[model samples]
Target: MSVFSARTGLAAALAVAALASGGCTQLRSHQGYVVDTDLVNSVQPGVDNRQSVLATLGKPTLAGQFDQGDWYYLARDSRNLAFRNPRPNAQITLQISFDQKGTVTAIRRGGLDQVASIKPYGKKTPTLGRERGFFQDLFGNIGTVGAAGAGGGAGNGSNTGGGGRDRP
Candidate 1:
């Protein structure tokens, strides 16, 4: 090849290499509260109350549903490459409990060891009770309804002329 053509070919190859490398790069993301170890460690039970924790760590990711005494701070770092599903690289679950008096009673921390993966068995969820087809479900109650003994409130078809009741 000529010198100018060789240079042009080398530049095109470099551009393609850069684009391919960019596609393989891992995409990193963060969700929920961003954790600071120093601030978290600074919180001491019996000393820090709800107000101080809120001021230090800001608002929690979630609070107790039934009772407002428990606070939960969740932080997760995830990464994925190309079309792959994102997987957790790191996770932090911080739970701070408070007594009825709103004083910090306990501080608990958890990591990825607490993560659980649940894969469903099939396309349709399994449920209890009999499985009926579409036609059966539509016409299953046809004969059962409006029948005399089926609590339809219609008297028997007797011809006693006493309104279907036996004479005394």
Candidate 2:
């Protein structure tokens, strides 16, 4: 083969290799919280109080809505490949509830099974108002332009004194 043809064949092989490598999916990692099983296991119900739980597991991720006695520690790990959306691989939610006296009443844990997917209903919301056509909107105020100010002689050229009162 000629040198020019050999060089062209090498270039084509390199281009094919580059395209094949580009199609490979890369794993993307996402971690919400650092999960420490020892710290979570140390927290005990009825024995551990609010202050003790805070001292053991540090601060919680979220507090209960409407009630201040509930503390929630959330940890999640999601993985995404290529341009697709990230999917949750693992999730841990530790919910610690306190009684009225600030003592730990219940301790619960959840995983990825509790995850819920929510989809939006529509693109635009329906509003309550009058809908007009193109011509109606363009020439809507033609006939009713001076209807309101007609009785006051404002738009009928009757009061053309530049809106200044006569100084005596």
Candidate 3:
């Protein structure tokens, strides 16, 4: 009945017709990735000490405290939807600590191939009061000055670096 409604209905019908004619398959998602399981199982706990594992596997994907001592091995595949380049998606992790004998007491592994969100690590900067003007700023602190032209001496004061002495 209304013009806007009629136009919307026609557009919907057109989209449906296009789909029936087979044009919507191209819109489906296509994700890319790589999985390295052998590399994953190679560094698990009870296998070897932390230094030995680090020598063989190089480095871990993430090494932080989940509990007392736990390492995480992460192999991920990241793809830019609009580009053809493959990013660094493969990662290995090793959590290590030196005991009385300097040995790896524990280890943990996780094969997280995909992550949707990333949180930045570091201190959060708190908001201060309104900024001050140029002269009123904290960094603009002026020191005690007995005199003003150049220095305690003169030639260097004149910029010729005579140290206030005119060469003969």
Task: Give candidate 2 regions above 4 Å deviation.
Answer: 1-23, 126-168
lDDT of 1 by residue, 27-129 (tens): 9999998888999999999999999999999999999877745999999999999999899999999999998888899999999987787788999888899
Model 3: residues >4 Å from true position, as ranges? 1-35, 59-76, 82-98, 110-126, 131-168
Tens-place lDDT digits, model 2, residues 29-72: 75655778998898888899999998998888988876755998
For model 2, the local distance difference test gives: 0.83
Using TM-score as the measure, the top candidate is 1
Worst 10 residues of 2 by lDDT: 150-159
Error of 3 at 131 (Å): 5.5
In order, what lDDT does every prediction score?
0.90, 0.83, 0.52
Query: How are the candidates ranked when ordered by TM-score, highest leading?
Result: 1, 2, 3
lDDT of 2 at 58: 86
Report the Cα lDDT for residue 72, model 3.
Answer: 46
TM-scores for all candidates: the values are 0.74, 0.63, 0.32
lDDT, residue 49, model 3: 74
